[model samples]
Target: MLYKRGKTWWVDFVDASGQRVRRSAGTTDKAAAQELHDQLKAEAWRQSRLKESPARTWDEAALRWLDEKAYKASLKDDMQQLEWLHSFLSGMKLPDQDCRASPCL
Candidate 1:
């Protein structure tokens, strides 16, 4: 379902895991909002029924790494390195290519 919160449209629905998911559609247009809502619902269904996982980005992996390694002695250094790397790899999807082979590096 889609509803407006202020001027932006938001989506609310139940996933295949029976969990309620709600998030902004990130659009002011109702048509765009509905499209995003449908996509989200379809992705959730695929994840549950076909055991498929959504594509993850480098930023997501970096954040998860930071969370898991919060206690590491080199965490500060790691964060600085990640910050620097973010400029070149901010939105690159995970497992797509070798970071070392990236032309940006």
Candidate 2:
């Protein structure tokens, strides 16, 4: 379901495990909110059916990559660059990505 929170829109739905999940649809437009809601719901259903691990957030993935590169000669430079990237992004998620396998309400 799509609802307005302040000036933006949000989606709230029950996941496969029956937990309530609420997240920002990231837009104020009704049609856009509905599209986002559908996308998130479909992705959740697909993952549950396929028994795949939950999608990872961009930040989590980036940090994981940094951690795995301890032996890289430019690790320090990479870390600094990552910090800058994260700061710029504010919050990072792919346009249609839902980064939760379990209900992360």
Q: Cα lDDT of all candidates, in order?
A: 0.92, 0.80
Q: What lDDT tens digits, residue by residue, belong to model 2 across residues 1-105?
A: 889999899999987767787999888899999998898888787777777666666688687888899899999999899888888764565444344765444
Worst 10 residues of 2 by lDDT: 90-99
Candidate 1 residue pairs in clash (backbone atoms < 3 Å): none
lDDT digits (tens) for residues 1-105 of candidate 1? 898999999999999899999999989999999999998999999989999878799999999999999999999999999999999999998874557788544
**Candidate 2 regions with alpha-carbon error over 4 angstroms:** 56-58, 70-74, 80-105
How far in Å is the alpha carbon of 94 misplaced in model 1? Answer: 1.9
Error of 1 at 56 (Å): 1.8
